[model samples]
Target: METYDALLASITPGSGETRTIFDPATGGVVGEAPVHTVADLETAVTAAVAAQPAWAALGHDARSAALFKAADAVERSAEELAQLLSREQGKPLNGPNARFEVGACAAWLRAAAGTPLDPEVIVDDGETYAELHYRPIGVVGAIGPWNWPMMITIWQIAPALWMGNAAVVKPSEYTPLGVLALVKVINEELPEGLLSVVSGGREVGARLAEHPAVGKLMFTGSTTTGKAIIRSSADTVKRLTLELGGNDAGIVLPDADPKTIAEGLFWGAFINTGQTCAALKRLYVHDDIYDAVCEELTTVANNMPMGNGLDENNVLGPLQNKAQYDIVANLVDAAKASGARVLLGGNPDPGQPGYFYPTTLIADIDNNNPLVAEEQFGPALPIIRYSTIDQAIEYANALDVGLGASVWSPNLTAAREVAARIEAGTVWINKHGAVDPRVPFGGAKQSGYGLEFGVEGLKHLGVPQVING
Candidate 1:
C-alpha cells in the first residue's frame, strides 16, 4: 500500500494511464494513482454488488464492533495519518488536530449503530394499525473532496456502513493516500469489499454516479459537478445526497462588537485555507461599525503567518492546487480593478512556492460583483455594507448558494432573530460554521440537499416501504 501501484491491485486499470498526485505545499510528486477508466469502475461496482448483501446480513451489532475497532486503529495511527493528510491537503496540522476528525468519524459510527429497524406499531380507532420501519437502500456511491479527505469521507461513508450498506468510496485524486490508509485499517475489522476505496480521476467519479448497481450516490464538491451528478443519477433514479458549493455569508450587525466579530471572521472564512464547503465567502456589515470591523480584521490578517502545514507557527497553509491559487489571485485582482480596495493581504508572497496565497480581504465591493456572489472556494473574503438588518439578510440570501450563514450581534435576542431570517441550512448566532456530532448539517437551495453527521445522517441511507397486512 506504500506505492500507488500496490494500491491499485484490486482494480485493474485500462490503457496503463495514471495521474500524478502532488504535495500542495511543496509541489512534490507524493504518489501516482491510476486514472481509472469506465471498465475499472464497473469492476469495483461489480464487487460491491456481490458483497453488499452478505455484509448487510451481518446486522448492526457486527457493524458496530467493526467501527469500534476502527476507532482504536485511528487513534493508534493518528500521528502518521495526520502528517500524510497535512502533506497532501495543505492544512494547518497543529491548530486543528487530525485525531479530532478520526474521533468524530468513530462517534458517527457508534451513534448510527443499534438503530432499530422494526416497525413502530400504533392502533387507531381500535381497528387500524399503522407501522413505520427503516431499511437499508443497498450499495452507496460516496464521492468525497480533497479539502478534508479523511474527514469528509468518514462524514459520508461511516453512517452508510453503520446502516448496513456497503459503500464504494471515491476519494479526490489529489489526496487519495490518506483515505486509502484509513480504509486499510477499517477493512481489517470489517469484511473485504464492505468498505472499498477506488483511487482514480473524474471518469471514475462519473461512472460511480451513473452506475446502475449503485443504489444511492452521495457527493460533496462544487455546484456545477453536483448538478451533473443529479442529472446522471436521475436516469437510474438512484437515491442522492448532495452537499455542494457554498457562498456562506457572515453578517456583522450594528450591535456586534468589532473585536469579537474579528475572531469569528478570521476562523470562519480562513479555516482549511478557505477550502471548506461552508466557509464564509461573503461578509455583510452594518454601516455604523463597518470601518472599525475591517480595520481590526486587517490587523489580525496581517499578523497571521502563512507557510507549509508542518510549521508550528504557520496558521495558514497554501491552496491545495494551482487552479485554486489562480482562482483566488484572479478574483482578488479583479476586485482591485473594479475599485475594491485591499485592506489587508490581497497578494501572494514572491518567495513562497506551490499554491501559497496570503489571506485576502476585499472591501467596497458590490453585492452584484462576481467576487461577492460566486463561490470563491479560496482564502479571499469580500465585504459588503448594509444600513439595516433586513437589508443584510436580503444581501445574504441574494446568492445562488445557501449552505451556511453567521449572524453576529451582542444582543442575543437580536442575533437569533437575524439568524432565523437567513436562508441557509445552518445559521450560527455570535458564531460561524460551528457544528456538533449530535446535530444535522447540510445545505439548502442551490447550495445542495441531504443531511450529514447526525441521526438524520443515518436516515439518509434508509428506505421506507409500506407493509399493508
Candidate 2:
C-alpha cells in the first residue's frame, strides 16, 4: 500500500462501506481500498465525457504518443506493479505471472499505439466517392477482472484510448489496487480525467454499465454480468466489448503423441491456476490414448510447484479470493462424490491457510459431472474420454459459452480440420489461450459480442459513418 500512497490519498473516502484487499497467499490483510458509489461513477463519467473530445481532437498520433509513454511508464514500474498484482490476484510472481502480465501490458500498449485504423473506400469513381470513417465513441467505462487485473485492464482501456475514447475504469474489487496504481502511473502521462479509476464492487460496475454518459462499456469478466450490461446499455444502446466467461475444451486426437502434448496440455488448462477465461477446462482424449494422455498430463501438473506467489520457485499460487476458492472446492467435491476418478488432486487441503488448492486432475468424468459441466475456474481439470473425433467435437460444442478451444495433433491438416469445426471465436491447433494483440478476440453464442484486440477491435470502439458525395 505504501507504493500507492499518493493515489490512495487522492481518492475521496468511501461512503460508509469499504472494500479490503487481501493477499491470497497468506489470507492476510493487504489494505482497504475505496468502495466508490454510483455517484462517484457519475462524477468519473462526467469528467471523462468532458475530457474525451479534447483528447480525441489531439488525433491518433498524439494519442499514440501518450500510449507509448504509458508503456514506458509500465515497463519502468514492472517489478513494483507485478509484486502488487501477485499479492492481490494470487498469480505467481515468476513464470507467466505478474511480471509477465505487466510486460505484456507494455507490449499491448505499444501494439495498440502502432495499430492503425485504416479507412475503407466503399466506392471510388469519377461520378461519386463514398467511404466509411471510424470516429471515436466518447467515454468508455472499462470493467476489468481479477484474473489478470493489470494486463486485462490494459487490454480493456489502452485500445479504447488508442481509438481516441477517454476511459473511466472500474477495476475488479478483489484486485483494484494494482489497477489503481497502474492508472496513477498512466494518468501522469495522460490529461486529467482522460483516464480515471473508480474502484468498488458489483454496484459500481452496474452503474458504469447503465451510466448515460458512458458511450461504450468494455468489460472483461463473467457472461452473467455481460448479459446484464447488455440489458442496461439498452436505453443508450452503448457500444459494448464484453470478453466473457469461457469453458474452453481441448481435444487430444488418437494420432497425437501424449508425451509430446502433455506439457502444452498442462499449461493450457492450469495457467493462472486455471483462473483464465480462455484456459482449457474440460478436456476430451480419444479412448485409445486416454490413459497415456492422462498419465502424462498428471506427471506435468504434479511436478509444477504451488505455493506463495512471492516464492521465486512457485509457479502456481492460490485462487484469487475465498469465493472463487469455494466455487472450485465445491465443484471438485461434487465430481468426487459423483464417482469421477481423481487421478491427482480432488479437493482443497483443510490445513492450508491461503486459498490454495492443488493442481488437480480428475479422470473418467463425463459431461454430466459438475466439474466437467461447469466452469471450475480454478486448478481442477476433468479429463473425459471420447470414442471418436465426432463424439469429442460434439461434446465440446455443446456448451453455450464459446470463447476459445484447442485441437492437439501432430498433423496440422487434421488439427486445422478439427479446429474449424469447434464452436469458438478462437481455436488453437497445438496451443491454447495464446492470444496476440494483432488478432481479434471475443466470443460466440452467450459468451457475448464485440471483438477486442487488433484492427477489428479498434473499429469496435468507434462509430461507423459513411461519407457520400
CA lDDT of each prediction against the hidden true structure: 0.80, 0.88
Instruction: Tell me the TM-score of each prediction against the true structure.
Output: 0.93, 0.96
Give the alpha carbon lDDT tens digit for every residue of 193-297 in model 2.
Answer: 888888877888888888888889998899988888899889988888888998999999999999999999988999999999999999999999999998999
lDDT of 1 by residue, 273-295 (tens): 78888888899999999999999
**lDDT of model 1 at position 221:** 90
- Model 1 poorest ten-residue lDDT run: 1-10
| Model 1 misplaced stretches (Cα beyond 4 Å) | 1-17, 97-103, 114-125
